[model samples]
Structures are given as C-alpha cells and as structure tokens.
Target chain A: MGAMSTESDPLSVHDQVVRSTYACIARFGMAKTTVEDVVRESGLSRATIYRHFPGGRDELLREAVAWQIGEFFIRLADHVEGSADLVELLDRGIEFARQAVREHALLQRMLVTEPDRLLGLLSTESTKTLPFIAAYLLPHLERARAAGDLRPGVDPVDASDHLSRLVLSYIGARGVVDLDDPAQRRDLVTRELLAGILRP
Target chain B: MTPEASPDVRARLLDATFVCLARVGIAKTSVDDIAREAGISRATLYRHFGGKAELLEALGQRELTRLDAVFAAAVQDCATVGAACSVLVVEGAEFLLDHPVLGTILAIEPTAITPLLSLGHADAFLTAAAALVAPHLAAHVDDDAARLRGAELLVRITLSHLQSPNPQRSITDPQVAQAIVDQYIVPGFVGKSAIERIQA
Candidate 1:
C-alpha cells in the first residue's frame, strides 16, 4: 500500500494517517494507541507518517478525533436535510443524533471504560461545536419565522443557539421524552421542545 | 466509632469532603484528609460512610436536595412561567458557577469533573435535577407530561451553559439570563399567544 501510495496526493496521505489513527484508537483504546500502531494500520512508514503529521502521535490523535466528529456532523446534516419546516428539522435531527451516538461502538465503549478521555475531547471541542450547529440551523429557523410558524420576537440567532444547546443536551443524556417511543418523540419535538419558539 | 452515626457528624464529614475536594481535587483527596478536615477520626468517618465513593455519592444527593430547596425558594412567588424561568436560569447559574468546590474543581481538574457533567455519568444527575425543577414548571404548563418535558429541557439547557458557558454572555448575568428565558425557555412551555400576552 505504501509503495502504491508513494506518489499519492498529499491530502489523501494525511487523511490515510488520520483514518488509521482513528481505527487504532477504536481497537486499542486511546490510552494504548501508539505511533507504531497507526503506522502498521495505515501501512505507512514512520518517516512518512511523521512527515504528514509534524506533531506526530499527539497531533494525529487530535486530528483523528476532530475529523471523526466533523464526519459525524456532516452525516447528521445529510440525514436531516430537506425537512419542510423547523419542527420537522428538529425532530429528524434529534432522532438521528440520538440513534447515531447510541449505535457508535467507540463512543459506547468510551462512555463506560474511558469517560474522562471522551468527555475531555468533547468539552474542548464544544466551543466550536455549538456555534457550528447554531450556524447550520439558523437558516432553517429563519425560514420557520418567514412562514409565520415562529413565535413573535423569536430572533433566529438566539433561537438557533437555544435549539442547538437543547439538542446537544438531549443527545448527551436521556430526559423526560423517550426518543425511542414515536409518540413521545413527536410530542417532544412539537408540544414541548418547540413550544416556546413556535406559534400556537 | 459509634455504630449509629449522628446526622450532624455525617453532614460535617460531607462538608469536609467538599473542602478537601476543592483543595486537592477528586483524584487526590484521601480519607485521612477528609477525616482531618472534619476534625474526626478515620474510624468515625468510616462509620458515617463506607468509603470515599459512598461519601461522594451521598454528597451528590445532598447537593441535589439543597438545590431543590433553593430552586423552590427562588421561583415560589413567580406569577408566570416567564418569571419563573428567568429566576431559575439566573439563580441556577449563580448557584453552580459560584459554588466554591465546583468552581475550584473546574479550574484545577476539569477533566476529572467533565465526565460527571457529560454523557453516561450525567444521566442520573440530569434526571434528579429535572424532577426537582419540574413541579415549579408544572404550575405554568398545561399538564404533567408537558411540565416534565419543559423542566427537562430547561434543566438541560442550563447544564449545557454551565458545562460550556458562552464566551460572549454569562448566564449568571440577570439580563442575559432574562434574555435567554424570554427567547428560549418561556416560549417552549407557554404558547405564542400567551407569550404575547405576557410580553404586553
């Protein structure tokens, strides 16, 4: 693979190393993942990997975690795309996010065995994450407002931030609404989650 | 060591644990330090709590109970959901952000604290907190289920802010809290027309 990729695009090489690091962390756990493991997994030489990631293992790990998170959000955005209105958008987004996290094997294992490492990564990333989510939802919220679905005096920026925070919170922990139950999930999105922002 | 520990002694030990935790953090706090801080023997501390884990768990419970009382007092006389939410957000932010032990722990050993405030481990805390705050919200909402959902949403948003406070605005600021309550929270429980009435 190294021989075949000797002349590969630089970005692809960087992506290969990051992908390998993610796999290593998933299989060996964060604490045990090493530079050598990433090299072996990616079938790349130490010198090549070092050349791609100047900061070596630490940089590789950070980038890998970040890349995976970005991918997760991208997938989530795609999953909830084309919702007719704000209510449907939130309903689909929240449900998709919950299911994805619950089904993610690495996240599940980290939750049980290495919560600190996982949470540390998330908390540090959250500074960027919240704003990104809010930005993504802003247009949809505005559309809802234009459609006369939003309550009076609901600014899209504040409402986007509000919705982003609430969604993130629900994703982190189970609350009163059971997303697994369809009826409850609908009620959560419509009657409760969107109540203050939406028109009666 | 007394076989039956007095409630006073138990409370003192928990208080001491908080001090120790603030000074040395969760990972470094020792039984001897807690006992010494409490002005009690190790045996007496043991009589009150089986171990550090049990003591910490009890302390968590006590803190929640205390929070319930504080929340009740803060929102007791509010005439509307909007007023209650403003008081709740401002008061809750002040309570958590100004807490000596939590403030210290967040500063010195955030990684150790992040897990407890994040996913998996945060479920129990979130549930209890939502339950404690739900009744106050019930007075303004239509039914029991909506009350619970609104309470949980509010609790989650408050916690999210606590976990990762916005750089631009502090929730502890009354004006910011009120803005958040008006824009995000009150609308969720009270419908648009009612919100207009309240605003008017």
Candidate 2:
C-alpha cells in the first residue's frame, strides 16, 4: 500500500510520513494505529520512519499532533487577522474553533473514536500547547494592547493564556454554547469573556 | 419488595454503574453487567432506567449534585462576586478533577460524554451554580444579569482548565488556581478597579 506522491523530493518524505501518521490515526484511532500502518500508508520502509522518529509510534503520533496544531493556528491567524477589537477577535476565534472541531479530520476522529485519549493528551500536554498558542497570539495581543484595546493592567502573555484556555474549554465541552448562531456566539464571547479583559 | 421506582434501587444502580465503570470503562460496561453487578434482573434494571443512556444520564446528575454541594459550601461565606466565584471555580475544578467516577469517565469515556457537557446542560448547571453566588453578587454589582453572566464565565473557565490544563501550570494548586481566577476571572464579575484595589 504505497502512498501516491506527486513529488519525490527528500523533504516531502518527511511531510509524507507525518501525513501518513495522521491519516492512520484518523482511520484507526490512537489505540489501534500501529507503526506498520504508518509505514504502509506512507509507502516508506519501517527503518526510514524509525530513523526519523526513533521513539517509534508514540513519537510519530506526537509529531503528527504537533503538526496538526501548528497548521490549525496558522489558519486561525488568518481568520482572526489580529483584530484590535478583542470582542470581535474572540467571536471569530470561537467560530473558527467550532468549525475546526467539526470539520478537522484528525480532531473529529479523535473526538468521536478516542475522546478519552485525546482529552488525556490535552490535559497533560496542554502546557506545551498553551505556550505554543500564546506565542502565536503574542503579536496580536501586543498590537491590541498598543492600540489601547485591552483593559489596563492586562498582560499579553496572561491574556493569550487566558483566552486560549477559554477557547479550548468551549471546544472541549462541545455543548457549552450554541455555536450554531453567529449572533449568540458574539454575545457569549463578548459578555462572558471579552468584557472581563477588554476595555469598555 | 422490589418497588420499581425506589430511590434505593436508583442508588444501588448508580453505585453499580460506578463500580463497573471503574473496572472496565464505559465502552465495556453494559446494562446487563450493571444489572448483574447490582444483583438485579434485567427486567428490574429496565424497570428503573429506560436503558444504558438513561442510567448514564442519571449518573451524571448524581455527580453534579455532589459537585453542587461542594460548590455551595465553598462559596457559603463569600460576600463579593469575585470572592465567591474564585472559591467556586477553584474548588469546583478540584472536586471535579478528583472525584473518582467523574474523573474516570472524563479520562476514559470522553467521547460518549461530550453531549453531557453541552450548552443546555451547562447553562442549567451555570444557572444553579450562579444562584448560589447571585445573592452575593447582587450586594456588589448592581447590573442585572451580572451574577448569571459571571457564573457562566466562572464555570466555563473552570471547565476549560480542567479539560485542557497548561502543562507548566497546576490547576490543582490553590495558589496557581487562585492567581488565574484573580487575573482572568475576577475582573469579569467586578470592574478592573476592584481587582486593582484588591491587589494593591
């Protein structure tokens, strides 16, 4: 079962391995996916994958998760666009998160088939994820702070962590809010969240 | 006498559900197993609970009741919105995270339980959690719906942290949890100056 590749460049093999791992998790779940599946999916030899991820399956899975999150944040930045208005930014962030959870292949598979595993990783590894997200948000938050959009005494690091946690909570609970309606999403994010940190 | 709708039966069934869940997890714990564990016939189990879903729902409610008691006690003496909410949020997170049944379900059966965390249930929980702090909030913030909104935010924040805690931060630690509440949560209920004054 060789992966169909349009490009044979050396760097693409790394990308191919990561993508294959993600697809295996999406199809088989964390508990059931094996290194052999990654090898088969990627059309790469087991030795090659082991060379790249010496820790084996777990390492590959970890890398895959990081890659997926990295890509997600990039898309998130585009949608949020560093809005000066915290409320508007939060509204957009919530919308993007809801859609991501619903549509992201990896996330949907994880949520449906191995939610506990996903939650376990999130709870334990979120320390890594939080800083990663906060760093991504640092620039946006700093820009907002400079524009005087944030309330006095708000730290961008703190704000990024707090906002990231807020978004993660909404995403995890799934039923905490009606993400279906755009107006309601704005109202909840603004009234419940932005009001606390954003300038009046 | 096997009274079909006895509280004793409900309690017995819930206890059995906990034992089975702890041992084999939600995916493996079946209605038949619960009934067998409770030493009741399948007919009796069905007589009490419509099915496995109904029984699990009841288990969730039972856990919420236990949590409500913890939250009620935690906020009993607090006078201000921030004071009551910080205590409630911090204590609630600890209680939920430490509770054997809920913690196990969250760790092992996350996918099946997402719907249980949905907005409707969360709103209901928030409304209940807020009612405890509403009187205190009323004495402080004159704005209508402030207490309800604050409760929702507090609960959401706590839920988020519990679900996906920062790797570097310990939500279970009182100092860390309190600081987060102080920085991100308190200001939502009280104005920024109130937090500033308290900090100063």
Candidate 3:
C-alpha cells in the first residue's frame, strides 16, 4: 500500500529500489532513467541494486511500471466504489482511466519528453498490462453479468477483455464521442459498450 | 514499383522504409537506410520527401490508403451495411495482424510507432474508414449523418480490437469477430427490426 517500505528494515531493499526506480521514471522519464539514478534516489549502492535486479535498469524499470499501474488501479477502484448504477459507474471508471493514463507521471513525461520510450510501454509491454487490467476488471464485469446487466451468452471474461481493449483504445486514440461531455460519455457506454454486450 | 515516375518514387521509398523497419527497426532506421535499400541516393530521397519525418508521414499515408482500398473492396459485395460491417472488422483485423510491415514494426519496435498512433491520428483513421464504409451504410440508412455515425463507431470498435486483441480469442476467429459486429456495430446503423430480420 505504501510507496516505499520503511528504511528501518534493510530486508525491504527491493521495495526501496523499486520505489526509487518509480521516482526516477517520474522525474527523468523511462528512457533517461538509469540504474545509477535509482541507486542515488534509494541511497543504495550499485552492488545492492544489481543484486536485486540482475537484468539491470530495464528490469528495475519494468517492475516500477508494474508497481505504478497497480497503484493506479487501486485508486481507480476507490473512485468507482459504491456506485449502484452500472452504466454510470463504467462511464466514470473509463473517464478516470483515461485521465489516469493521460496524466500518469511516467506516461505524460514520455509523451511530452521521450515519446519513443512510451511506445514499448503501450505496445509490447501491454501484453503484461492488458491482462493485469482485465483481471482487475473481471470481478466488476462478473458482478454485472450476475445482476443480469450483460446480455445472455456474453462471457464475463470476454466482456472484461472487450472493456479493457476499449479503455486502451481511448488511451491511445480518443474516441469519436466527446469524453468531456458526461451525457456523451454515458451514450458511448450505453450505445457502444453496453448495447454491444448487454441485452438489447 | 509503379509505372509512373512519381508513383514509382513514392512506392520505392515506402518499400525501402518497410524493409529498413523490418530489418533494423524504427529507431535505427534512418533516411539513409531507406534510401540505400531503395537503391537511391539520399539526395533523391530528399527530392521526393522533405525529410525523414515527411517520409514517415508519407509511409503512414500510403499504408492507410492501402487499408482503405482493402476495406472498400471487402464491403463492396455485401448486400447490407450490417453485413459489410461484419466483413470489414474480420478482414481488417486479419489484414493488420498479418501485415508484414505493420506486424514487424509493432513486434520489433512498438515504441517507435506509438507517437504516430496518438489521438490526433485517430480522427484521420476514423474519417478514412467512414469514407469507405459510408456508401454501403448509405444504401441501408436513410439519414446520411446516421450512416456516417455508424461507420465511425464501427471503425472505432475495429481499431480498438486491432490495437489490443483479446489474448484468449484469436482475432482471426470469424465467429468471435462476427459476434462483435452483430452485437455492437450493426444496430447503430440498421434499426432493431432490420437487425432481427437480417439475423432471421
């Protein structure tokens, strides 16, 4: 839950390294962030950092990205918490996802400062992120399906995968619908997402 | 590559770009590499394109043009826009996934391609797709705007699927891809009555 484990425990060195790598990504973007940068931020020596991540800076960076995305999903779940209306909840959740991706410290930095680095994170690296996100979304979709919100014969797994793909599409390319308009956003969900997957 | 000098010049440059991208990838792929592969000097390459950026843009344009033509041909024989929508997504997904140039670039260096995949280009892609699909939709839908709207949503959904395919389901699966078109895309263009009639 915490970004960093307490420094009092030396055994939490891996967490410290990961936290430092995250900070370095936020500050310098992923392309420029080096193992030395993580070492400097975490106050760990090069030997210790290398011991934790034998693959070096890229390994550390990937772990840091995973950590950041996990934190992001937690915050998103909290934001979409307690909504009784499934459509509204989905709309809000998707909007939150869009803003979260657009404003993510690392993603924003990469888009503005080091765009080439952002590509791998979105493309191939997405092999990891997409499944992770779908897993996070599955429970909610299953709940909706159980409530008879989804169409008959619609698999919850498929729906969740579809939703995740939809969200990623928005992140990479804005939809034709205006996301800024709550009504339009709701229309997109009801028409594009819900109608497509839900009972007609 | 083509008969006319201008067309030949463009085709050669794009082909060379694809070759370089397939071989060395986008980051290491320079104008010089493309020129060398095309059997032309850098000066000749420059005469055709303003710079590397322009060349890259031209390649993107050529790719889209080819895609548009494919979609047009795929949908031309369909009796209904709803049917065309189904064929378009399935065939389009196949084309994108099986495309040597696109698949190779996305596989080897997705990071280099992300910038071009931004929201700014989504509009262009949607518009191009709509232009090809609208004629088919127009034959079914009375309202021109409604036809265009349906095509836009269809393009949006297809693009999302192409970008982030379900890990479990194959994009090449006709059953799954057809279901997406049936559930999501068709109803927007054809009325519910028509959909039922078509399905029946």
Candidate 4:
C-alpha cells in the first residue's frame, strides 16, 4: 500500500498530500501546521496540494482524520480479535489506545501544541474525529451485550457512549491523568470502567 | 439631546458600573458605588443606566461582544466547518474554564448568568455556539436524529464543562467530583448514536 500509493497509484497525489500534511502536523501541530508547510514538506506544488484537497486545510485534516481512523481500526480490531474476553480484550485495546493517545500525531499535537484547539475537536458534538470513537467501539460493545456479558437492561448503545464519554471526560481533564504514563492511567481507566460494567 | 445625556457622562457611568460589579458582583453592587467609581453624583449614575436590570443588560452586552470577538479570532485560522466548530468550543471552553472573574461567577455565583441577559442568555449562547459548531457536524445533517442527539449532547457537555468545579485537577485525586463531563456526558450522546446503528 505504501510503495504503490507513493509511486504509481492514482491517489499518489492524495497520499503525498496526507504525508506532507501529517509531517507538518507531527512537527508543528494543527494550530501552527499550514498548507504551505504540507506543500513544503511534500515537495509538491501548492497547486498540486489544492488539486488533491479542494477544501484545502480542512480537507487535508478530514483526510488525515479518515487515515487516522483507518489506522485506529487496524490496531483496535487486532486488539479486539486477539483476545476472547471483552474485559481482557478491552484492557489490551485500551493499552493500544493509550499508546495511540501518547504517540498519536493528532492527539499528541493537540495535547502539546494546541490543547484549546484539540478540546474543541474533541468536545464539539458532531465532529467526525470524536464520533469515530463511538462508531469503532459500538459494534463490539453490542456483541458483548448480545452475549449477555454486559449489565442486564443496560442499553448497549448508551453503555458504549458512556464508555467513550467516560474516557473523554477523564482524558479531557488535563493534569488529572498522565496521558503519556501508559501503564498507569490507561490500565486504571479500563479496569475501573470495566469493573462497573462487567456482568455481575 | 440634553446636558444630562452627555457621552462623557455615559462612558464614565458605564465604566463605574463594571467597577462596582467587579468588586462586589451584580447582587451586592449598588448604584451608589457605581457613582463613587465614576466620581459622579449618585443621580448621574442612574441617569446613564436606569436600574439594576438595565445596567446589567448593558454590561452583559459588553461581555458578549468581547466573547464574540474572541470566537471570531479563534476561528480566524480554521479552514473547515468541523475545525471551526470544534475549535470554537474547545478554545472557548478553555477560556471559560480559566477566566478568573467569569469562572468564579460561573462556578461560584451562577446567579449572574441565570436569567442570562434576555439577548445573550444561555439559550442564545448555545444557539450561537451551536451555529458555530453545526458546520463540523454537517455529516449528520442527513441524519437528523443523530444530529439532534449530538447537539443535545454537545449542549450538556459544554454546560457541564463550564460548571466543573476544578478544571486543573485530575480524576485520580481523592476530591474528584462525582459529575464527570466525559465519563457520563459525552458517552451518553456519542455512544447512543453508535449503539443505535448497531441495534438497528
């Protein structure tokens, strides 16, 4: 996927833009990152970048969002499927997520360079970035419910929403949990959240 | 039109109004104090802003104008609808969270915002904030149910964030509050939508 996309794919242009954009994001974060930076980093002309991304910066971010979502699912699905128990699976998955949180270009940028901007992306009701969380987690949560593993009569949807919100609430509360301290905050949140939700 | 209605008199009175409001707050602030702050006769202060309600309304407008400018500046660099919406709330929220006087009023003395000036009241504030945010959530435009649900969640989350007792604290702290903005609020909204698609 990488070589083909970079070399000959029709989306080579698009891929280049994403690469350039994220590289800028990696270095400067969303606030300081710019179309010029993406172009400069990609060695693509401004015209080429605009050619690939019509909405420009926002479009690039949206694509970046989709790209991130794809990567998140790849890791999350692997984590989910590798284990049988939802609790254990989620525990592992949460660790993966925590690692993602610590290392994620977007999350890292938001946390370090532009917390105000990041919180906006995260807290806004309809932003694509935040909802991807629910979409990714919902299916498996429902599966847990169907298997009679979740608390009875608890709306699986509500429960899933609760889980994400719970994470967001805590994660959003900066200075509370050490985001980079993977073993500490990540494990505890998953454990405590699961403790209350597991069928008892 | 009249000597009693000079611009200098009006400006002096307005400044005094805020000075009194700042030192004592709306409830305890009195017209006499405003006059003192302005170095004017008590009768002169009333001449500019008639009663408490009128005085408060003017002050609130000034604050809203400042907030509006802040909102505009925050989004000046944003490119897409989602970025704009998300950034507005995230940045605005942080500002609301840390703003000393405003934060104190919101967290400790919310009565100041309750009837919220008829013009820039809570509903109006949400509506404008929602408008600012609605662009990013546009994907849900076709999904009214999801959009509305998301909007409701957004409103609740924003209010909860504003009302949060300690913004700088962590979840692990012993004195952590019972109400969690993300744990309960965000999931309740985002998760519900995700669960709905699954249950469907």
Candidate 5:
C-alpha cells in the first residue's frame, strides 16, 4: 500500500504505531502488547519501531496511554460542557467515566495487579486526570452561579478535585466487574450514583 | 450456616474486631487477631466472618452508620444547594479523618481502601452525605446523577487526601483549599456567581 502525506495524514507513521500498540492492548492488554504484536498489526518491522523508539514497547505504551488519556479527557470535557444541571453534568461525566473504565484494558491491568503503584501514579501528575477535573469545570460553575442556577457557597474548583478522585475510585473497582455480570454490575454502579444523592 | 445465627455471630465477631483493630490495626489484625481479641476460638471467627473481606465489610458498615449520623447533622440546615453540600462534604471528610478506626483500617490494610474506593455498597455513605445536598440543588437537579457523580469524585479525592503521606495538614483554612477548588472546579455547576459577585 502506498499513501502520500500531502499535508494532513489523519494517521501518521507514529500514529499507526500507537494505534497498533493499542490494538494489541485491546487483544492482550499492556502487559502482553508485545513489539512483535505491534509489528505484526502495524505491518512494520520490529527493527523500525526500535529505530524510532529505542525504549521499545513500554515507551510505545507510554505514548499510547498518553494519547488515549488526552483523547479521553477531551471527550469527557465535551460531555461535562454539554450539561447545565450539577446532576446532569455528573451523570454525563460518569457515563464517559464508565466507558473509560470499561474500555481501558491497560488501566484495569494496573489497577488489578499493581494498585499501590497505580495510586502512586495518581499521586503525581505523570498520568493523573485529577488535576484537570477542576480546571475543566470552574468556568461552568461560575457561569451557573451567575445565572442563579448554582446554590450559594459551592466552591467549583475544590468540588472538581473532590469529584475527580471519587469517580476514579469507582472506575478502579477490582475484579468485581470482570468476575460478575458486567451489565448488572454497571447497573449497580448507576444505581449507586443516582441513589447516593436522591432526596428522601 | 443458618442465616440468623450467621448474622449474630458476624456481629459478635465484628465487635471483637474493633478491639483487634484498636490494638493491632487491620493488616496485622487477621482472623487470628479477632479470635484472640474476642476470646473466641479461631474456628468460630472463620465460621462467622469468612476472612479479611467479610471482616472489612462488617467494619465498613459500622463506620458508615457512624458517618451517617454526623453527616445528617451537618447538612440539616442547608437552605441552598451550596450550603447543604459544602457543609456536608467537609463535615463528612472531617468525620472520616476523626475516626481512628478508619485511620487504623487504612493504615492496617491499604487494599481495603478499594472497598470504599471501588465498591457500590459505599453508596450508603454517599447517600447519607447527599441528604445534605439534595435540598439545596435546583428542584430539577437529578438526584441519581448528582449523588452518583459526587460520590465518585468525593471518594477518590477524600481517600487520596487521607492516604497522602502529607496532605494539607496545617493550613487550618478551608479558604485556601477553597481557592484551589474554585480556580479548578466550581464553574461547571454554578455559572460564575463567585467571580461575578465581586464588585468592580
């Protein structure tokens, strides 16, 4: 196959590598997403990947994860921005969150096998989504408050961090979902989210 | 194996668990710990509470009940959604930190952190906390959405803070943390009351 880059290549050589890495992850996850798999999926030789990325598979995965993180955040922000009500904002947010937790095989692998290490990742900014939660929502809270929609005294920024960590916790539930009925488990999560704040 | 006897035995075992927790903490406080602390034989402890998991749930349930009482009190006077929520969330955090038992639990058994972080049963705490917020939110506020989302965020950040090697231990000021939260999170819920209210 011969394709020209002309100006905008929707998927680049690097992009293909990243995508292939993720494809392998989809099949074998972060641990098993080998260079051979990437090479086979990508139609690129292992030598070529090594030439580009000396660090090999871990480096490829790091980039893949970083790219995935950015894309996921963008989508999540769009969901948050689309809603007005506090409840709705969180609802959409959780939906995106559920999807992320359900789909991200690598994150799940880390959560299951290496929680403390994952927690350490959360503690720092290398791969944390916590830092962005407030930054994403502060504008909306301010806008809502001015519109008299937001109740008095709610600190939007602190609330964001507070909420970010909470959602992460939900997404990180260990083996409970994999071992149980996935849909029923998801419903239980949805129920907990809604029921947790329902008025008596 | 009868349900009635099982629960009673579970209760007695959990009560004994508190003594073990107080003395050794959750990690070191194994099945033997409960047995020895309760003056019950090891076999009896196993009969009621299968192992660490069951012991943890029993303890978590007890702790949730304790939190429910304080949380209900904190938000009792919330006239607006903001007041009802802020007061409740902060008070809830305070209660979590105040309970040496919880601290002991976390310190003793770090993985147990997952129960609150990942499991659905913890919604009891979320619901109790939301009782404070439900009144102040817009009448149309989605209870299901808000509680679920809020709990998700709240659980992660609160646990992170608690588990932090050194969280903001000495600021003695919510305002500082509030500023962080506002610059970061509030705008999503209230459109700009915090920023707009300032007279130029």
Candidate 6:
C-alpha cells in the first residue's frame, strides 16, 4: 500500500477509488470482489473509502460500474463526433459500439461468469445511461433537422431518445441484422433505424 | 416413472418449473422441487429432462413458442402494417409486463431474469422474436429485408421499454403505443405515400 498522504482533494480521492475498484472487479469478478480488495488496490485506507462512500462495498461497486460505462460513452462520443448525416452517424456509432463490446475482454468474461452482476448494473444504471446516450445523440439529431434531412414535425429530443434506445438494444443483442457486413449495416441504418426520423 | 417421455408430461414439467421459479428464486429451485410442483416423481422428471440446464432450455423453448403464438394472434386481424405494429407493441408490452412468473422474479430477484432479456443471452431471444413476428409483417411490408428489420425493431423497442419503461410514454397505453408506432415503426417499414394513406 502507498503512503497515506495529506491529499485532501475529494474528487481525486473519488477517482482513485473508482479506478481501483474497477480494476479489482476486472481481476477478481463482481461477486467475489470485496472492500479489502479495493482498499488494497487503491492504496487507500478502509476509512477513506467508507468516508467517501457511506454505503461501503455496494456503493463502491455501483460507482465503479457507472464509471466504466461513462468511460465507454466518452470514447464512443469521440469516435462518432463528425459525420455527414444521421445515417452515417448511426452506422458508425453502431459499428463502433458493437466492435467495442466484442473486444471488451472483461465485459465478455463477466457476461459468462457473473451475468446477474452485469445485468444488475445495466438495469439500475440505465436511468443514468439512457439520458447520457440521449444527450450525446441530441446534437446530431438537431443538426440533421436544421439541414432538412429529418422528417417534418419530428422532434429532435424525441428522435434522439428513440435512436438512443435502439442503439443500446442493438449493441447488447445481435438480432437479425449482420452488423459485420458493411452492406447489411448500411441497409439496417437506412431502412430501419433512420426510417422514422429521416426524410425520404 | 414413465419409460416414454410424452409431450404432455414435458409441457407439465416446464409449467411446474415456472411455478417453482416464481415461488423460489432460480438459485433455490431444484429438480426435486420441480417434480413435486408438477405432481410427478423425480424419476419421471429425469426421464423427461437430463438435468436442470436441459430443463431450463426446454422452458425457454416453450416460452418462445407461446410468444410466437401470442404475436400471431395479435396481428391476425390487422389490414395494414401500421395497425398491426400498434397492436403488437401494446399487446406485447402488456403480455411481458403482466406475466406472473416474470413479474414475480423481477420483483424478487431481477438479476435472475434480466440476463435472459438482455446482455449475452438476448441475441437468441431477439432473433427468435423477430423470426416469429416477421412473417406477420411480411403480409404488409413489400420488401423482404424491410419486413425482417421492422420486426426486429419492434421487438427491440418493446423489450427495451419493458426493461426500462419511459415515464412520459408507457407502451401499454394504447394512445402512447399508437404514437410510437406512427412516429417510429410505421415509417421505417412503409413509404411516405403509404404513411399518408395509413394515417388518412
């Protein structure tokens, strides 16, 4: 364990705890991870973690999962920043998200060994995740509306929320659409995902 | 113990499994409990299913068959894609939300149920749902790909709402479901002229 410095920055302390907790979960697993593991990984005292998170282990786990989801969206937002239109934006966003999930070793492992833990995070954290996703897509939808690319009378807020839900579903589940094939991805985006919001 | 495995006995065992799952959580339910619930001997249960995993798989298969029948019945009377989709969304939401076993599990141990609906296992669920609903949609949607895409979209949206229902828009409400159908589902499957005609 590192020395307990006199650092009084609450934000930095919170960040360190969360990052350490994520690492612990990635290494040990959600069900088996404990406060001791986090304390050891974080190089922080049990008192410090309890002070920051009054709820202790449960609170730390929630925060860690939320932090990971936040990091994912931040990367996704950056990847999908600039696009020609809504279709391209959706196509890229879907592809990027699908690929990211597939390549996430920790997530895949968690899904196999401890699905309940991961599903619990998703269902509870969706309250935060959905709004975050909607906010990320709202600007693009608004720009599309301004460019006359969107259907008349389609509200950008509603459209963004709708798109966010679909994108989240597609990312989690690989239904009929073969996202690996560029042609299928484009067809899905144009004909189904964007059909309601975009102008013909 | 019956030497031959009858379809009726298999259906009975699956029904009993749901009863046991509803009564106790998945982790607590066992083959003995399921056999007792079905009023059958342990030998008969083993004769039907090799073990718990096989029994659960059969339960999942049974649920899908029932869901397909529900979807088929829901859209049998509709003349247009928009009308059929509206009925499907509302009816589908109500069916999933009001299922006794799912409601009990969700209330008691959501972690036990959420994985099957989303995350790693959701792909098969969504694929099966789409396949079941696509033929009904094909009657109205002219394009083959559009029909499948529309069916999958409907399933995805419904499942998403069931997982995290919107405060502003409840899919079980007919007016709200119709609004979603008109704004999101209908346009994707049909053209602008058809939308106008359907609305008119």
Best by DockQ: 6
Q: Which portions of model 2 show Cα errors greater than 4 Å?
A: A1-12, A21-41, A53-66, A81-92, A95-128, A142-153, A170-191, B1-7, B27-54, B106-148, B167-169, B172-178, B189-200
Tell me the lDDT of model 3 at A6: 54
Give TM-scores of the second chain, every candidate.
Answer: 0.85, 0.75, 0.78, 0.59, 0.59, 0.86
Give me the runs in candidate 4 sitting further than 4 Å from their true place. Answer: A1-12, A27-34, A40-45, A61-66, A69-73, A103-127, A170-197, B1-200
lDDT of 3 by residue, B13-94 (tens): 8888878876766678888888888988787788788977887788878877787788778877878666677777777777
Q: Of models 1 and 5, which has the larger lDDT?
A: 1
Which sections of candidate 5 miss by over 4 Å? A1-24, A30-67, A75-127, A136-200, B1-12, B19-29, B43-53, B72-87, B98-111, B115-200
User: Whole-model lDDT, candidate 2?
Assistant: 0.70
Off by over 4 Å in 1: A1-13, A43-59, B1-7, B138-142, B190-200
Candidate 4, A22-95: lDDT as tens digits:
66776777777788888788777788788778798877865665676566657766766757665566556655
Interface RMSD of each: 2.3, 5.4, 3.2, 13.2, 9.3, 2.0
Instruction: Compose the digit string of candidate 6's lDDT tens values, residues A63-132.
Output: 9888978888889888987787778888988899889988989988888888887878765775468878
lDDT (CA) per prediction = 0.80, 0.70, 0.71, 0.55, 0.55, 0.82
5 versus 6: better TM-score goes to: 6
Question: How good is the docking of model 2, as DockQ?
Answer: 0.20
As a whole number from 0 to 100, the lDDT of residue A198 in candidate 4 is 52
Task: Give the CAPRI rating of model 2.
Answer: incorrect
- Considering summed lDDT, which 10 consecutive residues are worst modelled in model 6 chain A? A1-10
Which 10 residues in a row give candidate 5 chain B its minimum summed lDDT?
B191-200
Alpha-carbon interface RMSD of model 1? 2.3
Per residue, candidate 3 scores C-alpha lDDT tens digits across A28-49 of: 7787899888878988789888
Which ten contiguous residues of candidate 5 chain A have the minimum total lDDT?
A: A191-200
Please give the ranking of all candidate structures by DockQ, highest first, separated by commas.
6, 1, 3, 2, 5, 4
